[model samples]
Target: MLPWLLCALLGVLVLALLGKVCALTRSMEEICDQLADRLAGDTNNLLTLSTRDPHARRLAARLNVQLRLLRQQRRRYLNGDRELKEAVTNLSHDLRTPLTALCGYLDLLDRQETSPAVARYLDQIRSRAEAMKALTEEIFRYSLLAARESWDWEDVTLNQVLEESLLAHYGALTQRGITPQLDLTEVPVHRRLDRKAVSRVLANLLSNALKYSAGDLRVALTPAGEITFSNTAPGLTPVMVGRLFDRFYTVETGRTATGLGLAIAKLLTEAMGGTIQADYRGETLTLTLRFPPAEEKAAPRAVPGGGGVE
Candidate 1:
């Protein structure tokens, strides 16, 4: 009778322990869901546990404190970023008026040319002014796009976009005595992307090649929707390639560039559920960009529906 009674008591204890374990598990799951929501969104909600477990309550209290701190830091970052973008936009706007005036005066001076030396000096000044203007415009566009919270997303034929971008950069490539080798797959790789953003990304990559290529360029597109821009850039190193996508990163000789091209491309690519990478080996620099196919999964867009990237 004593052994039988002891068995019954043990069984009841086991049942209670099992119930407590299940409750704790449910509380942890709830905490995870709430944490994920808070991280992905701007919410002030804290973890709400249904279980009365003391351990679970303590964990929730700790997490709540962390969440509040996290929110404070996030708010500060957003505010700082907004201010920086506005500063960039305003500076670019202010510089444009003076730049236009400077270019006009240079043009006027060119028309009434004096000595050969003066003409040469004028040419140098004009070239420098043009370079500065291009840099300013690029910065302005990057600033606006960086602050962009929306994008036009639609079904885009990757092959067509690649071809168009190539054609557009043909003049610049040929002028540099570089004829790019092309190997594009005929299969139409389709993606839901911002056409303008993708085009801008291509333009930046090509422009990067123009600056760094050692007179050779090879472009290829795979059937699986991978586009690579390869160039024999003898001067580039693996270390340099690693930082290619960072904003305002430039090599010693490429000071004329604001180094925002690849940075903007990366920014836009990620925003569109795409990726961009750079690899350097044996004096060759290859830049690859990929976007998820539209058929695979639905991706968010700047607007619920639209197209293009910048």
Candidate 2:
């Protein structure tokens, strides 16, 4: 009877040890899950566990302290960023009023006749004023874009928009003695994107091409909804190509451009759940954009019946 009693006590101790270990394991999993949720979401919840394990409780307490510190830093960063963008927008807007007045005076001067030398000097001043005006306007546009909070997403007919953007720039391309080559897909490709944002993105890219293309431009849209804009840029390096989408980045020849074109495109494209990339290959520069397809199909929006380099 004594031996049987000792065996029963030992069995009970073993079972209790197993139960404690299982409880600890569960507590660790709970802490892990809560920690992940806290990181991904903006919430005030802390790690909560079922068991009263001293070690796990201490671990959760330490993590909660760290999370509080992290949240504080994140808040500070966001506030600073928001304030910077607002300041830029305000400054750019203020400069526009004076710039407009300066340009008005310059135009008035252009009308008055003078000697060839005086006229030549006036022309140089006028050109500088115009360039400043352009830079100011581009800065304004970029600042506005940077401070934008959201865009309305909808089903957009991808091919039609591309055609319209190309046609819009037709006159400019022709004036530069270059014809844009377009190979848009016949099949109607649709995507879920912000229409106005998409238009702005394409406009910026085409403008970039106009500013930098050696002598030709080619635009193509695949059936799968990939859009590519390719041109021969005579002196672009791999490093320049890599930073093409960076904010306020421009090449020596592209001084007239504010360098915000592709940056804004990238910002809006990624915001709309799209991808934009630039590649420089053997003197040719190519920009590609891919937008996710819509879950629900919609009819193509009406567009003018002409496409093919306008």
Candidate 3:
């Protein structure tokens, strides 16, 4: 009697175990179906395959991390592509304006009857052509500055460069009747910068000052080597000041300037490890260019002379 009872109990235990095994198998199948659906819908999905197993959970976590990285990379790629397209469009439009102007000027110069008036017209055409050429060169320089590549730096004298730039623009300043007050110190200050880049920046600033300033223009170089160019022009509003360094932003009067001068100046200054800022105070527009301090090992001695525009 005892043996028979034990056999019945063992058979009942075996049946219960079999039932649990079958239930687990069904659960696994459902989990697999769900996983397959998710994978088919989106390869980027992070959900794990259906299973009551620890291994699936670990795999899903690892896969989620990889998916996140891939998504970030994809987003960056899309953004870069969009920016490239926009840059190309802007380049095309800017180039078209100058090229069209050149074509029209050439056509005018090719006409019959070369009278004095015709000669004057030809001179005007030539001037416009030169302006267009300068515009193209500036655009190219701006593009180069905008690129992510680095530039070669050399030790250059800031005071000397400033003097040379001012001298070069002396004729234009005289023609425009704008007197430049130079407050330069005789101290020779050395800075690690690209010479060409610094010259371009000064040229742009001086050109803009001559073009826009209706009154006195003051360029002061401090003992600490902070150079400020201030012109007595109409005060700019806060909004205009905010966008003053922006590309293609002309003033309220719709000036004929290409509006890239200040923007390029700011960019090159920064690239050469310097800083630039624009401020409007008391009926004057001031643009400041600050260079990094000279290295301690360098010897600086003489105080520079004061020169005014003739």
Best by lDDT: 1
Ranking by TM-score: 1, 2, 3
Better by lDDT, candidate 3 or 2: 2
Candidate 3 TM-score versus the reference: 0.61
User: What tens-digit string does per-residue lDDT give for candidate 2 at 1-310?
Assistant: 9999999999999999999899989998998888999997778887888888899899999999999999999888778877876787788889889989998988898789889999999888878878787878877777666665555667789999998998898999999988988898899998877788889899999999999899999999998888999999988999999999998889988867777789878877766667899999999999999875754333222111110110
Winning model by TM-score:
1
> Model 3: per-residue lDDT, tens digit, 111-148?
86688987897778776776665566556555545643
Candidate 3 Cα misplacement greater than 4 A, ranges: 1-110, 113-137, 294-310
lDDT of 1 by residue, 115-223 (tens): 9999999989998999889888888887778666767667899999999999999999999999999999999988877788889988889999999988999999998
Q: For every candidate structure, what is the RMSD over all alpha carbons to the true structure, in angstroms?
A: 3.0, 6.5, 14.6
TM-scores for all candidates: the values are: 0.89, 0.85, 0.61
| Candidate 3, RMSD to the unseen true structure | 14.6
Which portions of model 2 show Cα errors greater than 4 Å? 1-21, 113-115, 294-310
